[model samples]
Target: MDQDRGYNNYYSSRNSRQYEESSNWRRGNVNWDSQWPTDRYSNSDYYGYTRSDTPFNNYNQSSARYEEDYSRNSYELDPRTMEFDRLVELLHPKFMSEYLNKILTFLKSNNTEICFPHIAPYKEAFLVRIASDHKNLECPAFDETCQNISRSIRDFLYKNSKLFVWSHSYESGKITKNTADTASSPNVILKSSSSDAIDKDSKHKQSRLKKKQIELVSTDFKIQAMKTILDFIKDDSRSLLQYPDLSEVQANFLYTLLSCYDKPEDGAEKSLLLTPLVEALKIYSLKYQFRINKDTNDEDCRFITLEKTLKGKSSENNFNDSLKSPSPSIMDYQDLDDWNTDVENSDATDHRSDGVPDFGGKLNKNQRKLRYLFDQVTTDFKMTVLQKSLDYIEDNSRSSVQFLNLTIHESRFLKCLNSFPLSKKSYFLIEKQCVPLIMKLRRVLEP
Candidate 1:
């Protein structure tokens, strides 16, 4: 009986071990999410295929299995998901406060007095965080808002790195009481006199005149307004740094002031902003030979007499210079047709040190020749251009009382021109022909 019991026990133990191995193997092979058995691998099941023996059924089943496996684990370790999780973690109130404190510290350290004008405090904090941590951080690729925020941070950082200072003209600081009183002195007053015989007509006319006078603001007020804006820049230019285009702010300040004036004086029709705005643009456009309009309809032209009048003694020299010659024309330049033909026929070639073809060699050669042509142009033409610009400032009508040149109120013309990319010859030419005129105008216009 003992021997029989031992044999039964051994048999039972062996059966139990076999069952464990089989269960382990099944667990390894099967996916448990769907109903089990994979329809028992039967090709003729209700989800039916007529071919019971074909490998095609097995292939289809394997493909379905692969697709199910892919769907199950596809997003398990996705980079986008990871980044999204990180973003959420960092955006928590405590984590966000750390970033804001860092930004506030950076600003304090740098003496940067103002934040971007339009950005809200919270968004500014986010931008600071992104800029500070850009290289070490990642935004979720799937989250468009986060991506945009990231992009904006990069752009702001780049612009800040390459910031240009719009120089403030508030050198004199606040306008003084004495200066204000002097500025307030009326330069021009319009008066109308009519006989008492036509008393009703005179009353109506006087009423109309008073209304017109009300529309006309004093030029002094406009000058004072300009001074106010300059003071703002001097005090808090950090606030203006956020703008991509500096010109827009200048235009805005001028336009805002201009709108307040019903009908400005003839010469001061445009706010003082126009001159400086054009001056700033002149640097970028000098190669294109930018010049302010000198026609009478243009407000700038009206100011030229003021500029010239300020010139005083030099006005005699300018009169003599104007009498020296007529204006130069485009015809004065040499024909480049021959040069183009020569370039086309020439077989000359140059190569870079690295054996790459130098495509720009021909361009450089052409430009050199063009510069030579400019150099060879007659002094008369240069003189003519300068004279015409000066004369167009005015017809020299009130010769007894020197009229103001455009430079009278502002001596920034030469300063702005200095910023331009002038060739040596062009510089000398302008110096010889126009510098004296500019100097004269500036001297006269000096406050």
Candidate 2:
């Protein structure tokens, strides 16, 4: 009995040890430190998989792709392109330490010193602050560094201004004008090495440059004056009365000036100012007002007339007084018909001075022919309609034994046809002339 008890105790102890191990595994509390190999738990271990099966492969693949893309794009994103982008960014009012450092590095490399007048107006002090903040330095050293950076940036921009699109300096403007003028004038031949030719070319270019500079100055003044004129126009609706005798030159200058500001890409401030000015001009009936110059005959004529004034007449009362003026002999609208009639009668003996007669040969032949054909077609159509109505009435009369009813209906139909506004020849005159009149009207109304 004691031996049996010992066997039962031994089995119970073995089962208890196995159950404890299983529970620990389920609870994820298996002592890996004691049960597994030391290397198995190491961070460097890849379990049972090779490096190819690990996430490192994915990371390596992406890194390789990034390197390949960088290599492919390196040409376009070169140092020069980056520097240009940096310059454009610097055009804004504020910039950061990163931009300052870049400018400083470039300036130091170039071995340049900053000068006051070279930089943009009112930006030197701000640049000084930027330099101080960037280097955390004091005194003359900070100021000197700032000046160098500023001067370098300005020089760099001046040298490469063509690569960008911002407004050029007044001096650069002359250079551009000279280049453009030279390009436009193919007659001026360039001798690469002839001294006399070079001297002559230089003198010619200088003269042209001076003229362009004067023109540019004049244009600027004119633009300012035009703005004042536009403001005056906007102030009073009837103020256009103030300029009843606006000359062709003055009108053209205003038109050209307005067109320049009417660009789609105009800045916010320009658009805001120009919108009301354009509206005012349009409202004052100046939109379609222009004078024709017979000499030039060019679409953009110099002598454009927006308005004209009468002698001893108030402008406000006679806003459209110019309309009452005798039409120019050159602007003869009725002359075409008269000319054609004269050509038709050129072979005939009798001629009257009542211009073109309003009778047979008076009207346009094609228009008259078209009208006659249309009248004939319309008459035939009306006759056909009348015949069809008579046929229908006759058929009904044959089927019915009531002759009085048939005669009454026929008389009533004839009376209705006579009463129609366009049934008869005389009443159809308006209709006959309608097509030609509309055709002529269409020609006149064409834009």
Candidate 3:
């Protein structure tokens, strides 16, 4: 009876465990495909596919679908988004100061995280953090958006600040004078005769006259302005080297003044009338010692001085000698003719020969001839020698002056001549006479 009770107790326990497993399988609450299978998997007839048991798989698929729908639906932005983009477009990162206040206002209202991506998208977030830190605002956490915006703003401020400074510097450089002094200056009054009738002509005629008067006054004012500028330049205390732009401005002003005078048809006539201007230019040239051929070594001036002295001495000598020489009289020529006639008559009379004379006759004749020949030889030789000496003296006196003049004239010819090469003789003659006079005149003019 006790053995039977033991067997019955063991069988009842086994049967109870099987009943619990069947109940769990029927409920289908556990995932059979999961690595840790429950009682449902141990009792299930299906091996792999079971819809009721794969809750984790269903959850994952639903999450993925929700993510894809969220991504697609949220992508299509409205007009408001485009309008915000346009507003941001107005802001240039380089010149951010001009739009700084506006940007700050917009940033305060908008989520900087959203706008930050679009604004200053290139700079690093750390740089943006700096600006935020300076302003005592919450730092746009270090990211690409913050970095780009900060850098762009900084660069913008830097460039515009420089431009502003440059403009102020330029403005400061402009000439400024007391207005009271200008106002206090005396005004000129025009005096017209009572008898001078005012012509009330056509409106166009009056306008034309007024325009011409304005033009004339403007020209005079410009001339005075140039003179003022030149005076400033000439002031020794003024350091033009320090302010090179001043010189450039003066040059441009002078160029404009000259351009006003340059009329195509009357250019030559205008140039002729610019004597005062030419004189001013010459004065400027002298003051500056400006030359196309700059002689820094001072050789040209010394050579020119020596040349002038030699030329002057030679010219004076020639002039004095010319004055000293006696003028030839007509009687001197008559006397010369009479002497030649007398000698010819004597020679013919002495020569008495019918045919070719004997050697002794020839000798005797030759002796008379020899006596006459000897006397003639001595006289002719003495006169010829004296004449040659006088010629030499005259040539020497004139040579220097001629050489100086020739040089000057040739230079002038070279300047004026538009054709082929000049003849050597003509060039020589010009150099001998003209150069000396030019040099002397130049020396007299130099101060």
Candidate 4:
């Protein structure tokens, strides 16, 4: 019996030891709040996925671990694309190092504005801060390092913006560190006279490749801007008065893009698409406000009214306002003036920001015929809206349905077609000669 009791005590002691170890083991494993976690646990009681974009997940991650080239020029010392978490960590004003001030200075000098806020969609405010009141946009030039920085910020913008529609091609492809190291194998080259040529060629190729990729990404952003403008155009409740917050040069770029819109044939689609687009062209004309230099009716000779106002006076004021009036520097003003003369310093400005109408010198047939109508609208905008209802009264081509709708619509055109006793051809006596001329101006001449 005593032997049996001894065996029981030994077994009890062994069981106690095992129970203590098992408790410790369970405690360690319970902290896997993430399906995957290198540091074991998240703060949450329930473990799910340790999402990389958790506002502060890995906010303290070191940049050198991701990109060997984490410097001002914005070059990746290595080919490894920066991971998203690292970007957030680097750009976040609160969490970032002193280098953020350098970024702020560079952006400020270029008149770039970045906002940091609490409520942002997808936490974009922390990742990328871009937008500027200045008309000129200067991305990093062929300098791969500069563009590489632009590319990263732009990527953050590009990815977050995809919640809307069509969206770019050196998408810093995220991969394992081991994989990047393997993929970017060091070149086994001889230490010889030809080494210089080889390095130059390699650099040139890399720069070209990066440029193409970044430009493609920029194109995607521009496309989103175009779509936003289209939505603005269709909503008649909105107007150029509440025009999109774009610089005058940006407005011009959109104007050039507008002319290139592939208008569809007349149908429900035409009424839905082309008609509003036509109105947009008229409203958009406000941005392109300029007069032909009578001497050189050469369309190229057109001068922008915005030069003295937009780039000269207003830009200085805006800069002062942005910089909080810290003694405006002459050198900075000189640089700005240089920028004014050439609004776009990058290679992409081919006629887009040169302040020239995309339409050639010769006015289109409708533009020639309807000069008086549109010119009046340009000169006296408020009065010419009646041009629509007035034209409808005189238009023989107006469908019975169109005529009926206008009469009953309780619009500015209400009871405009026929107020009997006044001729059915009302408001027509003065411009009787225009019975044909008005019809001749039919190509987008209507309101």
Candidate 5:
């Protein structure tokens, strides 16, 4: 058993090293033949399948070409240094916030779950329990809701949240006031390394997080986040509400997600959260400033500073009379203050590492690469792929087969992920939310 594990690790290192060496080729520094592995089983030692097993028939060739072109043709990019705002100018603030407000309204009002086309036997129970736990919001892990309200909140806010501080612009997109002290990495993925008797205890704990979603968000945490924003507004909005670009509910969702980051190195990692958080804050022209004349006990100010001249608007609108104070009155809670009282008694940082965790476990090499693939892609793309894997897992889990080997279609999907153009960014963004399905996939493959 030990020999097999070591063997897997050895090949894993070799393949990754080869991939890294090719990284220089990718940079166009050398005239290199893109020596993609042709062997079927050579790279499958850790990941469990080889290239020949998964064909490119199912993958998007056009996207592959576009990414390749995008990667290679630096000269094609607009010669003038395009600002992040210029890159995403289409995302209008009024539309962004208003659309999100509607979604938030729907989420809070949603009473039942939408029946999915298919769900794995093992995952059904987990998804049901999760749906029950989260009264309104849709789970991107089970169904394709990534492009819906959830996607808008996570991607938009993840892009904007860090714009709050300006680290000199939240350290030019390095960190955020809300999640300044978040874990640099998530808890290691815990797995049974041996078929020995001691495995029983770990398996029990493992089962608890078996169906944890990629975006480890829960409603309780959002409530707490909403409470924090309201507290800041109540104490010192600094006439931030008077700013046309900023909205109460928009800020609530922004704080809720940017702060839900965890690393144990998984999807929806801290970088994802911070980037979007900063972007949104910058777009809204808002940030958190420290109260110098504190009572000395306060540790930090809430991330809620706002720039009055973000749009160069001098209109002194009634900050209080504009948008209503964001509240849960649509559902059960009477007002923001009511939820605030509840939050004070509960954990404020609900999705922080200490809460009901989806990660803080263990991971193998292929699994880490799989997670990195997720981070490199766009949020909607990552969420779509995660939804795909989840669908495959659900269908596969229902089969009462003697042994579950990778199907041809599954192989192709895996190949696409491994071969997908890798992208990297220097800082964190709003979120790369879905690690739930991949972790589940990891369990299935590894187990």
Candidate 6:
């Protein structure tokens, strides 16, 4: 029984030892002093777990070993030198060393110098202080560097200014020196030496002025041409006025006149000819008003008087046919038979008892003939004249229709025709001769 107890005790002791070993292995607490290779893990062993033998050591092992190596062999240096070394490591040695040397040299040399004008305090203050404080410094070397930097900045500004001018000119249609001068103040000269650049503005202004002149010339030419056509039509008395036809030939003539007037290269002499033509048209309009009246009755005496007045004025005397004959008074008619006899023998020449003679018979016959003549003139001849006059006005007159309508005196003649208690022949005569002439005058004057 004792032997069995001993076996049990031994077995329990061995199992406990195995369990402890397994727990130590799982916890990563290996005995490196005993298990590690002597040469590899000698004094350079990393912490307790790592040695040069294991490339797969964790971060803690590597860090502890590195710290131990540094503590043993690292040399002490000045704090500033150490810090500079750290900075040099952080930045690169080449760039940091060069920049630091430049700064040191600039500060030492410019000790007593002023770097900028008085107003630029932020940039100038440090420079001035350094320059003023350092007397034994080489300032020329530093000034040279600063000068180079200033030149570079100036060059950059100049390039940008040129670009601005180019873009502004493109946007505003064109750019010239004059435009630039206008856009910028006198103090702001674009640093340009080209003469052509300065002349661009003057050229643009000239071009615009020329365009306006051409427009004015075109308008003037049209006015002159219209005036010419009007004169031509007015001078021709055979034109139809009431409904005048506008022929292509007349239109072409008007167009030709306009074209000639508009000819930019034409001589002054050619243009001078238009002035008289215009004046003639004006004169014709002015003179037309005095020649006629609308009322046939008003015009009847006037017409006789005019013919009488015009007698011997013209080579051909056409007044004889238009003269009024002496007629007997209403009191001379005695009775219906006497009146009938008078009417029947109206064709005869006789003397009344009053010694007025039976001149009434001849007078009545002549008056009838005059009335017939007036009718023919009104329907055919006067109409032709009126139509022609209107045609001229329509083609030439610059005046408005309302102006012409108001100025013409034909309304009274039309009223007279409407109210006249005459036979158809007499009425037709009065209508044709009196109304048409008045209307023609109106057209000429107003149209």
Leading candidate by TM-score: 1
Q: Candidate 6 local accuracy as lDDT?
A: 0.32
Candidate 2's clash total is 2
* Cα-based lDDT for every prediction: 0.33, 0.35, 0.30, 0.30, 0.32, 0.32
List, residue by residue over 1-447, the lDDT tens digit for candidate 6: 232222222123434443333334434566755765656455453433435436345646644554554333221111112222232233233432343244334323423211112222112222222222332122233344443443443344355454322212111111122232211311112222243554565456554543343334444544654464554436533211111232333333333333333343321223454556544534554433212111123212111111111223331212111111122111111112323434454443332242121223334643443333232223444455345445544563221111112111232222222212222223233442445454444434431
lDDT of 1 by residue, 242-309 (tens): 11121322333333333323333222234354445333333323322211211122222221111111
Using alpha carbons, what is the TM-score of model 1?
0.20
Candidate 4 Cα misplacement greater than 4 A, ranges: 1-93, 96-389, 392-447
- What is the C-alpha lDDT profile of model 2 across 99-158, one tens digit per residue? 455544544343322223343322333343333232222223234444455556556545
lDDT of 3 by residue, 285-359 (tens): 444322111111112121000011222233322111111112211112221332444445665333334221223
Best by lDDT: 2
TM-score of each: 0.20, 0.19, 0.15, 0.15, 0.14, 0.15
Deviation (Å) of 27 in candidate 1: 35
Quote model 3's TM-score.
0.15
RMSD of each: 26.6, 32.0, 36.0, 27.5, 33.6, 39.3
Deviating ranges (above 4 Å) for candidate 6: 1-274, 279-418, 421-447
What's the CA error at residue 442 for candidate 6, in Å? 25
Q: Which portions of model 2 miss their true places by more than 4 Å?
A: 1-224, 239-253, 264-358, 365-447
Task: For model 5, state the Cα shift of residue 34 in Å.
Answer: 45
Model 2 compared with the native: what TM-score? Answer: 0.19
Distance from true position, residue 82, model 3, in Å? 4.2
lDDT: the better of candidates 4 and 6: 6
Residue-pair clashes, model 5? 59
| Worst lDDT 10-window in candidate 3 | 166-175
